[model samples]
Target: MIIFPFGKAPAVILVAALLAGGWLLLHPRGKEDANLVLWSFAKTHITAYNQALPALNHAYPDVKLSVKQIHFEALNRRLLSSFWSDLPSQPDLVEIEISCVGTYFKGPKEQIGFEDLKPRLVESGMYNRIVRNRLATWSNRGGIYGIPNDVHPVMLAYRRDIADSLGICVDSLYTWDRFIEAGRRFTVEGERYMIELNEQNVGSLECFLFQRGGGYFDSLGNVIFDNPVAVATMEWFVPLVTGKGRIGADLGSGQNAAVLFYKALEEGYYLFFICPDWRSSFIQEYSPRLAGKMALMPMPAFYPGGRRTSTQGGTMMAITKACKDKDKAWKTALFLYTNPEGRSRSFKKTNIIPPFRDAWTEPVFHEPNAFWSGQKLGEMYIGLADSIPPQYSNPFVVLAKGKLSQALVSCTQYYSVNGSSGFRDHIRKALTASADEVRKYQKRGLIE
Candidate 1:
């Protein structure tokens, strides 16, 4: 087994050598001549793409597409293993989640198996029509490797049934300071909490940090997890998820997390949670019982006029360089991404807004959603779509995710043990050290 190592550059080099030499797969696949295979990590994406096949075939009737769903981790491993090999099982196009996309850009430009689509975007006149910031996550070392599929603008959703009692209008939100005050008043002892914020999970912290214009990396691909905005975000957020007076609750993580959510949601254990455009599907799918009882709104800004939206989860589609029919693959991708009819169907199913501006005018996007208590969910998402901040991605971001997550836990733990007395000072030093660790890894990894 060519071990899938992470950390050291020497190990990365060894794995790259093993992959390039085609040692991972004994019977590597050649291109599938009969059909174009499209692999996706999410079942929802596969379903969404499958719905677009009719439109794709209508435009290019000769193109045959096979949409397949792969387990997230397995899909990533297979993507890496088959990227350098002439693997027959390799799909002509693949949908990679934002979190795993950076791992594929770990090596030299030649090693990046996805073809740059920047020229194609310009040629197709999509360069200006699409939300341009959404493209940053898919670019690395000046090469645009993927096409963005969604504008995952994050918002806040609360149980209106509970908030109504307190005369709190979830829609008429203003700032985080007021949000904190509301949480204090809204939270009840063991029965219900203000929101789902876990000490172990830094996902919510990242959302608020992004709202404050902070991220693991800057637009120039510089690591900036130690920036003042990050420090301030941690200082404000840590107290909410930690300490005896914590208003947030840890519902757990992973598959079991959903079960916890269903139960907690049924019991009204948490009043509010971060809701991105894509997350509404999970909400509807997992807890349909709560329909008509929920209210969705823009996430309250850190300040009065700060951005009301921050992007969370995302995915991008890329055409593999090894594919024999790059033109057919790109055509199929473009149709699925920009076709108004196909995108409308997919949006209703998943609530993920397309990055394409051309598809935004579809009437379904403006209709009131019954699931969100007659709220014009799509209209709200579109309104905030332009405001969704761009999230930068790089090979080092994978490491930064873990490092900063640990930094969050450390900062909160320090607050828990010693109280908030020098917590800000401690957070600065701690986050800086964490940022430096990612920098060191990047410095050495570049040596490869």
Candidate 2:
């Protein structure tokens, strides 16, 4: 069980490993054979495919599968680069990170990118079994290009030991207002605060955007940075970053960020950390000394009766249009991801929250986790999964997100100096200018 690092080494190792061992596979693909190649960066994803091979051979004797590991950013670039060549070396299947799926889906549809899986899904009678909204990440122009592998629902993780010591009832903090009030009470000089902020990252902003039913784009694929919902979300989050609420708003990235995050946990600098369910293993692996001290809880809603959870990270598997054996590849990919046994193995190996609703009925999903002092995390994850609002992204998301982050930083800085008056207009103007820049790319066909 190799817990992935939270630093920069993985990309370096991914390149070195791939360069040293070129096109390696568990079993050789015979010439003109029924072999399928999958490209991914996460070892757990590869492990799931490897674990399903035996069953795959038994069920469909001719289906052989292999995995190629590449750094995530490099993989996206190579996938796009393959589109320009007539005889390019392309994998049969590829893993599309949630954030990068837009790049593939945005271009002209006839450019020969990924295979549309909607027909195969309907033919297998398995289309409806999948959580439909999970397809949003990979869908464009009514074509669904990928099968989602995990549902990364966000939640709030707190230190149970600290909560008890401070006599705070965390379970009762059901709204952001209540949660912030609790933070005020939990603050102590020379001790832990409520949460640590990272200005270099806009994860908190994205989480709130998803929860408020606003994203980088609307359902029609138009950029909406200056929408009222977006402006309101930024307005709500600015104070948390700049105000004296036990939040560190200037955390750096790379090794410095990793060291600062680990130090915060090791030295007990905060009380709550908001992230996806996978952060459970991340914390367990990085801060092993904090075992049994932390516990999971639903995120506080923006308003009463509002959504309590929103999604963050996800990976979807898509079959390439260039593959020789499309039918065989579709069958292999579907079996590896949607089969009950395969889903079980993925959960055991990766600790990812599965998107298939039926998998929640298994006994393993009810077992208590010792890492958080016997918290029933599986049930909690499933419960939160039901309410995750639909998320939409555009090919311009990377640029738009940068604009939003800058808007946040500017508004925070201004509020820090001049207080909240006129902050709303400041953010609106900055965000509108950013949207105008994105519109130029849209007109030039850089993004759809």
Candidate 3:
């Protein structure tokens, strides 16, 4: 009886000890089930997320992920409000504009470190895949805060028939002077005007200033608007919009200008209009009849062979520190940005330009668009993308630009109403005041 009891006792004790050790190893301390919530403001980006999620889930099945959609404007406000509340439940992932990213970076300390995801991104080739310089600027800082998902650069959309009639080769119309001259020649009385310029349509002005080696702010964050180049650009723009040298109309708003532009195109009003890549899609949707008559080209340079581009609108994707599942979230963000099929789907479905450089040459962009005489719409967009420079306007810079524009408008109105003796003096004083305001933002470290 003694021998039998010893054998059974030893065996039972060994089995129990092994089981306890296994349990301890398998269960991590303070570890919870993986789940993530992604808040996206981009309506079209949802398609990209849907296509990318299955693959991500395949790699990480244990993680449950969900998306909450919000409008872009609403999302921006929500981010601002969240800063004040210091809430821990903010979105684990967000889509924000590059111009406003500085705000988030300057905000709460809860933002996840970019170093946390750098290894995976570099391994996945997403880090080195960006082709456009302009897009690169968005995430080129020491630690990448966001990934460029798409880009929309300003371009010149022209009526091929009218351009051909005027003996102007669209490709040759590369400089601002030539572009204006071409507009003047194409403008006919009781017919289409040459171009449309307005307060809201300031892309051309911004692009011109950029090309002439003049920027809104200097490297030291000083407002520098009274330069000779700026003066020249403004002088040129004032006449063009006021109907002095070209067949132009006073466009009070961008939407109003867009309507008149389309109407003019339908009636053969003007030969060219400044448009974005999204505009082509809009034209196809709203005025299908104008298809085959329209074509897009890069923005004209201020001088021959100068850089000719400006960013219009696009969205950026960033990971939040609040995410419980950092690895899974990084994988999802990489898949959406780098997958060829995923990028193509975004372009095909939403017309969003892929941030990946190689994708620009994909068949999706090169495919002849039926709306533009079967021309390769991708070529036009790619050209504009290539033409984009490193110059970017921060949120503060954008606000200052609006203020400066208003000052210019006010001066013009004063001249029109009061018959001011010295237009140059009035412009100088108004610009000086605007510059001082811009300098304040620079002092606050809002602009670069």
Candidate 4:
């Protein structure tokens, strides 16, 4: 036989190589990759995430996450459809607006409760730092569903120079009567009015209802907008739209009335408007000339001595049951909300105020905004934080709020075109119709 001495040596080496390959195929790789998807309609959040993700990856070297961005409304529809279709495409984490939480939670496949993630969050001091009764509340029946990342409340934004020129002390313009008087003084016969209120602005209705100690729905789950308080509030608003506070061309013609309102403020056609903290950036970017001339005051108090605030917009983050790595997701969310450096970066980059109570006390919030006359914009937000009410946690509220918005639009049309005859009666009919529609939705379990 023609055999070589190295033949056996070559066979042994081949066998050893095969064994090592098999071992590696079966053993762990030391790094666990997590597929994380995120959804947001807000452009600012997208920018914040781009900066936050790298820091998160560095903190957890062994884990990897990927984020996907989508518009808020589209994501809501897509998620609902996916669940209904029983599809496997689901995200590990979702960023939902506070108003839409009920729509998601009432569905058949509710996400993992916050109680499940409490241990990790508590250890990180996020739980203690969050304001208890604000948007971040643990449900009484079982689990926590939301971690508040940002908060925005409606406030009176006015032309400081105009108010001063009119000899109207802004501090004295707190009560409803005083506010009306100020608007009258600032309003000229045919030119600009004292203020602008429209059915298009939902915050006006919210503020009106809040001032009257009324809500769209009662605790018993009955629609209560047909009540005397609601009627009076609507009546108070009607004159502003019809004559006293003539609706501007931009108000009736835009997708974002607030943007138009801000434009009007710049053109000196509007002396006062209600806006949120995000408007500060808009003023900086759009109207540099009007910079340092705007001032943010608390929402007008209902009575002379009543509270001067109403809740507006904010976003929340939640972990889904579909999340393969809940522990890591919770860690990421906690760090985003509580870590001082992370929060400061978010504020500086995105202007998104952290919902953590302790974060409010940080100096970053108190820093002066050059656009607002070097005023400490953070102080204005702190004032809002003090007066925020208990978590308005009813999914029905969203539906009811939507229907009520339509009712306001309809009532405004009636008053504007046909004159205000039996206005409350017509509104009552609309409210009943809205309640019935919501009841149908409730039966279908779209809202609870």
Which digits, one per residue and each the tens of the lDDT, describe model 2 over residues 1-448?
Answer: 5556765598678878986677555455667543778899887777777777889899999877777789988998888888667446899888888888877766676664888888887887667666667767767777888888878888888788978988889778889899878777766645667876554367778788888988888866788867899899887877776755634343467768776887777777778887687877788778878888888889999889989998888888888888999888888887887778887666654567777777778877777888777888878888888788777756777877887777767777787887778888987987787778777778787542
lDDT-best of 3 and 4: 4
User: In angstroms, what RMSD does candidate 2 have relative to the true structure?
Assistant: 7.9
User: Higher-lDDT candidate among 2 and 3?
Assistant: 2
Please give the lDDT score at residue 269 for candidate 3: 64
Report model 2's TM-score to 2 decimal places. 0.89
Q: Give lDDT per model, in order.
A: 0.85, 0.78, 0.65, 0.67
Each model's RMSD to truth, in Å? 9.3, 7.9, 14.0, 10.5
Candidate rank order under TM-score: 1, 2, 4, 3
Give the worst 10-residue stretch by lDDT in candidate 3.
106-115
How do all models score by TM-score? 0.89, 0.89, 0.79, 0.81
lDDT for model 2 comes to 0.78
lDDT of 2 at 3: 54
- Best candidate according to lDDT: 1
Writing each residue's lDDT as its tens digit, candidate 4 over 60-84 gives 6654656667877888888767656
Give lDDT tens digits, candidate 1, residues 280-321. Answer: 878988989999999887888888888898999888899998
Clashing residue pairs in candidate 4 are: 187-194, 292-373
Flag clash pairs in model 2.
none
The true-versus-predicted C-alpha distance at residue 299 of model 2, in Å, is 0.4
> For model 3, how does the per-residue alpha-carbon lDDT over 1-448 read when each residue is reduced to its tens digit?
3354568878788779999989988975775443777778766677668667787777667756677788877887786676556567667677776556545543223342322344555787766666545444444233456677666666777777767766778777788777777777767755667765563345556655655667565543346676666666665666665533445654455558667656667877666666767666777776677877777777777767777766655567777665666777777677667777777776666555776776776787777787788787766677667555544434355666776676668655655554435766666777777777766766676322
